[model samples]
Target: MSQQSSKPEAPKSGGWIKPAVEYGPIVLFFISYKIWGLMPATAVLVAASVAATIVGYLRAGRLPWAPIITTAIVVVFGLLTLIFHDDTFIKMKPTVVYTLFAATLWGGLLLKKPLMERLMGTSLKMDHAGWRKLEARFALFCAGMAVLNEVVWRTQTENFWVNFKFGSIFLTFLFMATQLPMIKRHMLPDPAESESKGAAGE
Candidate 1:
């Protein structure tokens, strides 16, 4: 008789695709900015942002609030860049977005709710305390990033700010990766469920 082979199932394409779709526009904007300059790049970015939002809605059958809001802001600021012939508006976009996000996160913590938990409600499992702590940390990090963006953009040029945005995003990704172990450790397991399962087995 031939033995049956068993293999672990691969993760769904849907799981990884959202991040790629989200970042693709940013990458395109960076490249276009390098080759074509801010105005043309902002135009491409505005288009990409619109395309991303459409794709998000089509794929999920509903609009994601974050991307929808981001797209609107980008379009408005991008138009300002083109209409006024100044890049300052575009440069300030990240600062505004980050500051708003930071405020939301921190404010949620003050209200005894973690905004991140609401945002990632379907994806992860965590108790109220864990979520609150995570929210506090995220709020601090976002606030720090907003301050850093302000400092860099005010002291540096457009190219430098663009580079900083791209580089800092990668750095933040790495920082999150490093925190996964801590997150896993702090996660609360269902003690009653585990005990029932053990009793059933015994």
Candidate 2:
């Protein structure tokens, strides 16, 4: 009789708290900017963003490109806001972030890869076809977000934009949750073990 060995299971996914650590600064920035207004709050918000960026990099054991770039931009714009006494710099932050995200996603599509796959590479497993479909959906969502951001900021008050930014995070969570069903349905099972189980049963 031969003994069979079982393979190790994959690690469990990290909880939402992990992502909250990354986005918490943006939430704080929106809150502070609205409650205190840009003049008095911009410095504090920028500092928080910088701190969050550092914490994120430390937690991940490497610097993430998006948060690092965003932190740098926030610091530069925050300084400009202070020096010029103009809120326009701070106001443009969302536009810049969304535009960059949109461009990256669309560019990935052009290059025959999805930017989301690259970002989530270590976190999930899916086949090429699954990746392609997921990537296309994510790219479209990013583009839609970019347009929606522009529309809200242009048509609404500063406070409205601030609220919208905070609220939009919920939508992102929902979108991610919706993909789980598709992922489960398309995920490949362990074929060799399954065949062995069938033989044993027979």
Candidate 3:
């Protein structure tokens, strides 16, 4: 009889669509802001974020809750920016969103939830210690982003902050790329390999 593998199958990568899923909304918002200023750009951002979420769900067969949560914040802040006629609310979106993410990650660690594993366990096969390490580091990264966003929007000119926001997508992706080594170092043993070693009595 055939047997199922011990782990869930990793989900499909969603191919080239993944970049558009992640960055298209932000790029559109940047362009809109360049042409139309904050109010119209806020509207564009809110719509683009919603569209991205829908496209992501269609591609992956599941909603990406991480971005959904971020988009929700954008919706609220964007609405405020429109209603109140102040860009400050939208400007604060990144800080609040990143702070919430950091808090959730650290809180999950405190409660022993392994939240990162729950979200990525299928795609990432790693030991418990590895999961915990990745979780803590990601939490720290979020916290750092929150502080950085706050500093930029508060101290910098609007043009400077907008440029920084656009630039940050690449920085964030680069940071993720740098984590590949750590992920490789901490990979779990393949079940087939483990079984082979067992059969060999090694």
Best by lDDT: 3
Order of the predicted models by TM-score, top scorer first: 3, 1, 2
Comparing 2 with 3 on lDDT, the higher-scoring candidate is: 3
Tens digit of lDDT per residue, candidate 1, span 1-202?
2332211111233454456456767888899989998899899888998888777666656654666777888889989998998888888887777787788888888887788888765456777877887777777777888799889989998898888877876867876887687678767677779999999999
111, model 3: CA deviation in Å? Answer: 1.1
Model 3 lDDT tens row, 1-202: 1235422232444544456666787899899989998788889999998888887777666765687888788899999999999999999999998899999999989998879999888778998888888889889988998899889999999989888888889888887898888888999889989999999996
Model 3 regions lying over 4 Å from their true place: 1-10, 13-18, 193-202
Question: Per-residue error at 36 for model 1, in Å?
Answer: 0.7
Off by over 4 Å in 2: 1-21, 190-202
Which sequence of candidate numbers ranks them by lDDT, best first? 3, 1, 2
TM-score of each: 0.84, 0.78, 0.86
Steric overlap count per candidate: 0, 0, 0
Residue 72 miss distance in model 2 (angstroms): 2.5
